[model samples]
Target: MDVVVARIGKAHGLRGEVTVEVRTDAPQERFVVGRSFTTDPAQAGPLRLRSVRDHNGITLLGFEEATDRTAAEALRGTLLVADVEEDEDDENAWYEKDLVGLRVLTVAGEEVGEVAGVDSRPAQDLLVVRLASGREALVPFVEALVPEVDVEGGRVVIDPPAGLLELDEG
Candidate 1:
C-alpha cells in the first residue's frame, strides 16, 4: 500500500531544497538520503532524495530531479508517497495509514465518524475523527477509550467517557 509521508511546500532556497509538510510519524526513518518516493500526481516523481536537512524544526528535502528553485517550485503541493508493507507480526499496533478512513462507531453500533488522521504527540497519540456533524474530535488512542480496532471489518469501536466526545464542540 502507498502511504503519504510528506507534501512538498515552498522552495526553500536557490539550490532545489523544499520545505515539507510531514504526514508520517517516522520522518527521520522516511526522509533518508537516496530514498525514493512516488508522487500523488504520478508525474512530479518518483523523486529520489539527495539531501535532507532540518532548520528551525522544519524538514527540508532536496531531490535529485529538482536541481534548482524553479524545479523545486514545480513540486509544491505534491504528496510524497512510499510503499509500505503491513506488519503481520504486530497485531497490536496499527499504522497511521491503516487507521485513517476507518469507520468510527460506538460500542452500541452507533455511527459516530470517520477517522481523519492520527496525531502523534509526546504524551499520547490521538485519533482525529471527522464526526457525522462535520466537526472533528480528537479521541485519545487508548484501550480504555478505543476498545476495538477491526481493520478488516473497517470500523473502530470507541467507548468515549461522558463529555469526551463533546470536548471539541462549541
Candidate 2:
C-alpha cells in the first residue's frame, strides 16, 4: 500500500528547496535526509531527500533531482508517495490520512457531522467537523469524546460533552 507523505508546494529559496504540505504523522522518520520517495506524476523515481527544514512553521524539502529553485518550481503540486502499510496500533491513534472525511455520529446513532480536517495540537488533536447544517465544529479528538473509530466503516463515534455540539446554533 502507498500513502502520501507530502505535497510539493512552491519553491522556497534558490537551493532546490520546495515548501511542502506534510501529510504523514511521522514526518521526522519519513522525510529524513537521504530518504528516497516516489512522485505521483512520475517525474523521477526515488526522489532522494537532500535536506529537510522548517521555515516559519512550513516544511521545506530539498530533493536530489531538484537542484535549483527553478527545478523545484517545476515540481509544484507534486505528491510524494511512500510505499508502506498502514499502522493503527495505538488505541487513541488514527493517521491523518484515515481521519480525513470520516463521518462523525453520536452514540445514539444521530448524525452530527463529517470530518473536514484534523488539527494536531500540543495538548490533543482536534477534528474539524463540518456539521449537517453547514456549520463547522471543532471537536476534540480525544478518547473520551471519540471512543469508536471504524475506519473501514467510514465513521466515528463522538460522545461530546454537554453543549459541545450545540454551540454552533445562533
Candidate 3:
C-alpha cells in the first residue's frame, strides 16, 4: 500500500535540496540516497533521492527530478509516497491516518472526542482531538497522558492531568 513518508518543505539553498516535514518514524530508512518516491500531485515526481543531509536538525533532501532551487520550491507541500507492507503485528506503532477518526475517551470511559489529526513534532506527537463542543484539544501522545491505544477497539484511553484537556477551551 502507498503511505506518506514526508512532505516537501521550502527550498534550502541554490541547490535542489529541500527541507522535508518527515511523516514516517524511520526517515533515515525512507529518505535514503537513490530511493524514489511517488509524489501526491503526480506531476511533481517520481522524485529520485540523489542526496540526503541534515542541517541544524532539519532533514534536507535532493531529488534527481528537481535540480535547482526553483524546481525544489515548486515541490513544496507535495507529499512523498512510498509502497510498504502493513505490519499488523506491530502493536506499538500507530500511523496518523490510522489514529485519525478513532474515538477518544478518558481512562474511566468518559467520551472525550474523536481524533482529528496528529501533529508530529520533534520531541513527541500530539493527538488533535475534536471535542464535543467543536473545539480541538492537543493531547500529548505519551504513556502518561495517553496510556492506551486500542486500534481494533476504535478508541484511545487518555489519562490527562488536571487541566490538560481544557487547554483549548474557552
Candidate 4:
C-alpha cells in the first residue's frame, strides 16, 4: 500500500530544491536518488527523487521536473507517499491504520465500542472510540488504560479507570 512519507515545505533555494517534513520511520537513505514516490494525488503526478539531502534536521528533496524555485513552491503542503509491502512489527507495537475500526473491550471482556479514530498529540495519543450508546470517548492511549491490542482479532482490551466512561456521558 501507499504510505505517506513526507510533506513538501517552502522552496529551500533558487534551484529546484524544497524542504520536506519527514513523516516516515524509514531513514533518509531510503529516499535517495532513483526512489519513486507520489505527491498530492489531486495535483501532482508522480515524483522520482533526483537527490535527497538533510539540512539541519529537515529534509531537502529535488524532483525530476521541479527545476526552479517557482516550481518547488507550487508543491508546498503536498504529501509524498511511497508504495511499500506489508510487514510485521514487534509484539508491543501497532500501526495506526490497523487500530481504526477495531472493537474495544473492557478488561472484564465487556464490549465498550469500536475505534473511530486515533489522534497523536504532544502530550499523548488518544483513541477515539465510538461507544455502543452512540457516544464518543477519547481514551488515553497509555499502557495503564490500554492493556492489549489484537489487530488480527479486531479487538482492543482496555482498563479504563473509575468514572472514565461516565466522563464521556457528560
Candidate 5:
C-alpha cells in the first residue's frame, strides 16, 4: 500500500533542504515536519521529515539525517512514498492504486475487461483495461463515460458513447 508521494529534486541549499516534485494530490498532508517515508534505492533511508517549505512554487524538504547540503544533494531523484489511506467521505471516488485490479463492465452488466493500469495525463486520465480478447482498451476516465465505481463490488460501470469501445475492441 505504499504510494508514491513525491520525487526528490535538486538540492535546494546548504541547509540540507532539497526540492521535491510532489506526486500526490495532497502534498501538504504527505510532506510535513516529523513525517516519515521510505525511498526507492533502499539505501537512501526511511527518511523522517524535518521541515517543509515552498519557494518559487517548488516544494523543499529537509530530512532528519540529511543535515548538510552535501547529504541532501546525494538524495536527488529519490522517490518518497507513504501508506495508503482511506476516508469515510470517499464514496464514488477512487485512487489509481485502488482501481488497478477492479472489473470493468458496461452499464447493462456486460463485462468489458479488468483494469490493468491508469494513465494520468494533462488532458485527461485514462483507464487501461485488459479486454477479454487479451488486448488493451484505453477508456477515458471522465464522469460522463464512467458513471459508477463500486469499489466494494470490485467493478466499474462505464457508459461509453457510441463507437467508443469499437476503437479499442478491434
Candidate 6:
C-alpha cells in the first residue's frame, strides 16, 4: 500500500528543481538524494531524487531526468507516494484507510452507519458517517463521541450527543 507523501508545486530555480508541499511527517529523511518514489500508479516511472534541499520552509527536489526549469515545470501537481510496508501501531493511532468502509456503532452496540470519510480540519477532525437511511452525518472525532475503534472487527463505537444526528434529519 502506498500513501501520499507530497505534491509537486512549481519549478523553484533554473535547475530542474521543483517546490514540493510535503504531506508526510518525515520529510527531511524521505526526500534525500537517490531516493525514488512513485507519483501515481497509472504513471509509468518513479521520480528519482537527484538532489533535495530546503528553500525557506518548503522542500525543493531535483529529479534524475529533469534537467532544466521546463522539465521541472512539467512535473507540477504530481503526487509523491511512499509504500507502507508495515503497520506502525501506536496507541490511539488509526490510519485513514483502515477507518474507511468500517461500520459505525454506538457504545451499546446500536448501529449508526458506515464510515464514509474523515475530514481533518483546523480545529478538530470530523468523521463522515453514512447512515442506514442514506443520510450522512458529520460527527466530531472527539474523545467523548468516539470511545472505541476496533480496527480488526471493522467497527467504530461513537457516543454522540442526543439529537446530533436527528437535527440534520430531512
Best by TM-score: 3
**TM-score for each candidate, following the candidate numbering:** 0.78, 0.72, 0.95, 0.65, 0.65, 0.63
- Candidate 1 regions exceeding 4 Å error are 95-97, 107-110, 117-126, 142-144, 167-170
Candidate 2 global TM-score: 0.72
TM-score of 1: 0.78
Tens digits of per-residue lDDT for model 6 on 1-170? 78777778899889899988776556776787888888864372488889988777777889987889998888888888878554576657675788999999998889999999877544577899999999999999888999988889899999999988776775
- Candidate 4 lDDT over residue span 40-128, tens digit each: 75468588888788788667999997989999998898888888665655576555778999999999999999999776544577898
What is the lDDT for 71 in model 5? Answer: 96
Residues 34-129, model 3: lDDT tens digits? 988999999888999999999999999999988899999999999999997888898778888888899999989999999999988888889999
The runs of at least 3 residues in candidate 2 whose Cα sits more than 4 Å from the true structure, single-residue gaps closed, are 41-46, 55-58, 96-101, 116-125, 134-136, 152-154, 161-170
**Which residue pairs in candidate 2 have backbone atoms (N, alpha carbon, C) closer than 3 angstroms, thus clashing?**
none
Error of 5 at 103 (Å): 1.5
lDDT of each: 0.90, 0.84, 0.90, 0.82, 0.84, 0.82
Q: Per-residue alpha-carbon lDDT of model 5 for 58-168, expressed as tens digits?
A: 788999989999999999989887886666686755677778889999998999999998775446778888888888888899899899888788998998888777784
Number of colliding residue pairs in each model: 0, 0, 0, 0, 0, 0
RMSD, each candidate, Å? 2.9, 3.4, 1.2, 4.1, 4.2, 4.2
- Clashes by residue pair, model 1: none
Q: Which parts of model 4 are misplaced by more than 4 Å?
A: 89-94, 104-147, 157-170
Candidate 1 vs candidate 6: which has greater lDDT?
1
- How far out, in Å, is residue 49 in model 5? 4.5
In candidate 4 the C-alpha lDDT for residue 129 amounts to: 90
